[model samples]
Target: MTRPRIVIGNWKMNPLTPAAATTLATAVAREAGRVVRVGVAPPALFIPVVAEVLRETRVGIYAQDVSAEEKGAFTGQIAATMLTSYVNGTLVGHSEARRYLGDDDERVAKKLIQVLRAGLEAVLCIGEREDEFDAGATEDVLAAQLGAPLHALSESDRDGRMTERFVIAYEPVWAIGTGRPATGEHATAATKTIRRVLEEDGGIDGDAIPILYGGSVTASGAIEFAKAEGIDGALVGGASLKAEEFAGIVRAFA
Candidate 1:
């Protein structure tokens, strides 16, 4: 079966105003036809405005992150329950969260549990750092990053239903925001490695999962990644801030 196509924009702290947020959301919604699955994760504060604009559209709304702790005393953390009423899914274990916010694999595992329990989909980010990549251990690094979180799940959470809501994004730390994206071949190789780890180690039907390539993805570069056999779509960053560029990527995958 063909993996479903999707384009998810991670609008990390931009537009700088509610008016701009809704305007951008409306533009994206206008171009996001009913064909491919399209979603965006805006800053938490902007979610309400963006959601209001996208409510009747086919485009979906998502949260940038959710707290690993379900509730209470984790000051400044947004719980999954708090987001259940707003987003259809949440981005988990993003590299920025891992690098700056201290979300190691264990914490990522906990966040995954929370997102799943709240009945929201998760787009889990996994990749090797520049140093790890330089060591020629991309596959090993990818496996460990992905496996540790998955293995931490209970037997029941590892079942098919859990797999249904999970999406993996392979975004090399070295590639993201560097204006240099991974080649289609490199991304395809990484996707297969992720699939193998999910199936052989995690005991999940890996092929059923949609693995995306996310790294400084732009309209022109998106074509190569979209055409790659195992790459389902993208988790866009910078270029996603612009409606035309983002819609171009959606068209690439479509």
Candidate 2:
């Protein structure tokens, strides 16, 4: 099966105010019909407002992150179920989540389980650090991140009920927000690694998974990555803030 091409804009606490977020969300939602799968992850505070607006639009709403715990005394932690009604999915293991928030692969694994259990999609992020990439530890790191975590999910696959709802975004840590040059080639390699691990190690249908390339993705980058073999889409960062820019990227798939 040919996986659907997607573009996910992760609006990580930007535009300064709720009103500004509504404006951007509206802009994106207006043009979201251009792509088969397009989503935006706004700050949690604006989720309700944007969700209400985008509910009728073709665009999908995604949470930037979610708590691994189903429920607890963990103050300030948002559970997976909390976002189900609002968003089509949630993003986990983002570089920022792992860096500033200290979300390791184990934590990401738990978060994915929770997202899946709640019947929501998980846009799981996995990547290699600058040094790790230089040392050719990319595949190893991806295997550890994608392999051991979903081992238990293979049982669901055997039941023939688990459609490919999950997505993988491979972001090289060094390239994100640094304006580093990376797109087609880098994403091709990363997607191959991700697919191999999912099919060979995880015993899941790798070909059915939609793997995207993130880290400094621009409109032009989206055009390139979309054409590259094995690259299904893009997980845009700063470029996603602008409606015209993100729309151009969304149209790249078409």
Task: Give me the candidate number with maximum lDDT.
Answer: 1
Instruction: Write down the worst ten-residue block by lDDT for model 2.
Output: 154-163
lDDT for model 1, on a 0 to 1 scale?
0.90
The number of the candidate with the highest TM-score is 1
lDDT of 2 by residue, 122-211 (tens): 899999888897898988999998875677564764344344568999888978766566768767888888998988877778888888
In model 1, pairs of residues that clash are: none
Error of 2 at 17 (Å): 1.5
Q: Please, what is the whole-model Cα lDDT of each candidate in the order they appear?
A: 0.90, 0.85
Model 2 deviation from the true structure expressed as Cα RMSD, one decimal place: 1.5
Off by over 4 Å in 1: none
lDDT of 1 by residue, 1-254 (tens): 67789899999988799999999999999899666799999999999999999999999898989999989999899999999898999999999999999999999999998998888999999999888888999999999988888888888777678777899988899997675557999999999999999988888888899998888899999999988979999999988899999999999999
**Candidate 2 ranges with C-alpha deviation above 4 Å:** 152-154, 157-159
